[model samples]
Target: MNQLQNQVSPYLLQHKDNPVHWLPWGNEALDLAIRLDKPIILSIGYAACHWCHVMEHESFENQQVADLMNEHFVCIKVDREERPDIDHIYMDALHQMGVSGGWPLNVFLMPDQKPFYGGTYFPKSNWLQLLNSIQSAFQNHKDELQQSADGFAANLEDKSIGLYPVELNELTPIIPEVLAKISKYLDPIFGGIQKAPKFPLPSLTLFIESFPEKLDTNFDVYIHSERQLEKMAQGGIYDQVGGGFSRYSVDSEWFCPHFEKMLYDNAQLVYVYSKAFQRTSNPLFEEVVNSTIHFLNRELRDSSGLYFASLDADSEGIEGQFYVWEFEELNSIIPYEKHAPFYQAFQIKRNGNWEENKNILFKNHSVLNVVYEKELQTLATVRAKRIRPQTDTKLLLAWNAMLGSGLVQASKGLNNHKFLENAIALEESMIGFWDIKNNLLLHQISYSNQPIYAFLDDYGSYGLFLIHLYNETAKVIYLEKLRKIVNGVYQNHDQMNYLFSFQSNLNAALISNKYEITDSVIPASNSMLCELFFWSGILLNDVTYTLRAKDMLAAVLEQAAANPLYHANWLRVYSEWMENPQALVKYNPSNYAKNELPQLRVTWVPIVDQSHAFLLCIGDRCLSPCESIDELLNQYNSI
Candidate 1:
């Protein structure tokens, strides 16, 4: 075993047995690179990446390849989940080189840790040839390589100099143009954007939810949203027997998936489905929400009441082995009477839809029409006997907070108190991460038992969830915590207006700090921070917080206006900013009946206080306080 054997990350532990002498990314690796006069080979991947596994098996495990790597380089393995700060810097470097980046990121860095060259995955022959070439170039043309490295490092530094505040322009007209651009990419047949490998970009789904009127009237957004949700519900991307979605579909039809389930994806998806149900009152959306919640509760949640990071895509050395099934195996497990309905509903065929005569169960029919629950149970029972995929047990604060927020949204939309109870419990559990003395929120908790200082996402996402909890329970404590955390975010940043991806002091080894503007698989941390600041400003009556949010929004508005799909989260913030009239519902607990609290269809700022009345407010203006819930609803509707 190498240095990885002692590491806490499951991804690094996976490489412990490989023939390659791997070192975890740290001072030891850097020192070795300098002392031995070798370029550092930095490989970044997570436990759930399929291509990561493929490259590991092809190159890292081979003896000859290992010998070459050990001789020529200080090979460092970085689990991207564990140290996203490192991954972000190198991935940015790849983009600077005009290379499209993906997982299994391989970058060659100088001893001083400046990245010079990188690419994603490579075949064994190609990888071997590339290694020799890099080695030869490093030995023969040291001056040229150093010049290239210096230039790349300079570019990264230039990009890191903070965003400047632009004047806020009318974003209302740009909304229609953004929607028109989004409409051009929509697959009229399949639902999502017209792309081959379809990902459930929750940001897009969220944009649909927030801008219902704009999309529904002009773009048929409601119809398209339903189609997309239905396609995912019936597709193999969503586990038919089990109860969650995979990372994405490898095909445009959502027929075949990469088959890794991530907490962040499911959490945001639950919020999306819940909102869809709220809009349409569709039973299908409700079903998806409930099933997804069940999956999270059963598989991801630990005894600590926090959710795990993700489940691996492979099981027992074969990708999708645990999830996929042979037609004959299904035929034997399912009873005769149930066979035909199950087969017809799930598109089971003799030829098989996937590789090695295996079928990834799916239904092309309407999700509402499908009724094969009993058959699914039988299949699930049999599949349980097989090896299950490994779960990455690390608890990330941002992801857990996301799940908590989703549960709260689901609870409100579906009127299911159980989901609300779960969200509250998760909030209570996460309180341990709060450092009252230092005013810090730890990013993650792992087996190592060390406190990883929080990143921007940790503060933004968890802070947003705290706001949700405050709305649900009317608890002042949640609001107080939200304010404190948001304050910490500002304190950690050099500029008070915008947030950086990592805390300023954390990840000091990184070449530059990154500002996440575009939404990725998860919404940008900065966007979430902006929303938190905006809401906190209103709830606390703080002008500074409000102005900071507006400044950050103004800086990103031009970028968002140009390509709204990528900046969906930013657009959501802009939407709320433009439509500044927010309803503030103030209610007294003693006067109003517990069941009489208004069920909100539109977003509102709910406050619980000692006053025995309800006050409706739009911005700073307020209507006279009313005694009855019905009176409050009536006044709100009139506006």
Candidate 2:
């Protein structure tokens, strides 16, 4: 057994019995590399990555390749989900070396842990050649390799300030430009980033929701946003039989998805779909929301209600084996009377709609245009009997928070109070991750029951989600969590202007501390913090937090205008700010009708002071207190 045999990360455990001498990323591995004076093989990936599995089988599991690796390098295996900060740093180093980044990220670093060279997955022969070459280069060309490592190391800070922003552009002017810039990239017909291997980027939908300034008759932003959601819901990327979404579609038209299901992707998608349902009253979006929630609850969630990280892309050693179906299987599953239309709606070809005689269930038409829930459910039952994909059971703080906040939105949008209860309960369960005795919140709770130090996202994202919950429930518990998280973030704030480093006080500096500015699959920690502080300010009636939020947003806004896709979350907060949203507060908790308040229209910040009426205010700008919930809604609607 290798060092990974004792690790809690499922990704690490998967490779535990491999022939390669795999060491989980830590000081032990680093110290070993230095002692042996060997270049470190830093292989970073997660459990759900299909390519990672392929590489493991082809190279790490092969005795010959493992022998060469053991002879030449100290191989450190890092589960990216467990140490995203480490992944972020090394990936940035790879990018700096003029390499496009993906996982299984195999980077060769000097004994000092400076990355000199790297690439994605390599076949056994190529992996052997690379290992032998890197070793030879290390012995013969030590100075040059160290030089390359130094150059890459110097450039790995993420220049996050410049990349993300310090927001200088006025909200009014940039709002139109941000919309126009993002609109140019929209696949008008397909809906999402205009590219193949398309991800369900929540930023695009959330940005549209934030600022819906239509370009022209040729392009309506709202319709384009809805089309993307509808197309995704109707496509294979979404599990037609099951209720969750896969990581991404491998095609331009949302068909044939890369099958891993991520907690973050599904969580963000729920929030976006729920918001769309509120805006358009689209039942299809509502259906997607409810089903995805059901899927997460059933599959991704633990018995404790905390969601696991992701479901692997493969089952029984074949990609999409668990999700895809043979054409005949579909034919036999559908009712005899409904066979023809079900086949037509799902694009089920006799041979296959996709690879190797297997069909990924899909519809060419919009979800709203078709009704096939009955047929899909039948397929789901049959699919359940197949060997399931291995689940990565790492519970991440930000991810749970993302889903919890989405549920809060869905409950308000769909008026499902049961969803609300679950959201609250999920957060309540997360209390275990918080160390009340030490006042240290953790990013993950391991199998050994040790608490890992919180990252900025763990602090910021969960804090932001808690703030959202407080808005919905007016509960003190969420706010109390927010207080701990806010202090943790501030403790780690250091001196990086308005931005916070990705590492918390407990997280040691890697080669460098990553400051997330650009929003990717999830909002950057700084961006979420901007929103967190803004809402926290309103909720606590603290002016300092409001200023901190404004400062951070202003800085990010400067860099966001040029590339809105990268900084969509920043712009979303800025747009929400422009709306001058009032905190519809009531002095009496009994006066606040949970369902009566229009959630999307008004940002609720509950304060049960001694006042008699509902007070609505945008910072200092205040509307007269209203006597009834009806009166408050009337005043809110007028705005």
TM-scores of the candidates are 0.95, 0.95
RMSD, one per candidate, in order: 2.3, 2.5
Clashes of each: 0, 8
Q: Model 1, range 1-639, lDDT digits (tens) per residue?
A: 367887888899889999888998777788889999999899999998888999999999999999999989999999888777788789989999999999999999988888888999999999999999999999999889999999988787535333655566543556667778888888888788789788989988788677737446776667778889989988998988888999999899999999899999999999999988888898888988999999999999999999888998999988899999888887778854557877877888777888989999888877552367777878878888999999988788899999999999999889899999999999999966766677677777653434567878888899899988887777789888887887778666545335554545644447776777778788888889888888888677687988888788887877787787788888877765664334566666556544666676445455665364877766446788787778877887887
Once superposed on the true structure, which residue ranges of model 2 sit more than 4 Å away at CA?
Answer: 158-172, 212-219, 335-338, 367-370, 447-450, 579-587, 596-600, 610-612, 627-639
lDDT for each residue of candidate 2 in 113-191, tens digit (9 for 90 to 100): 8999999999988988988899999999999999989988888865547445443433455666677788789898888
Q: Pick out the ten consecutive residues of candidate 2 with the lowest summed lDDT.
A: 210-219
RMSD of 1: 2.3
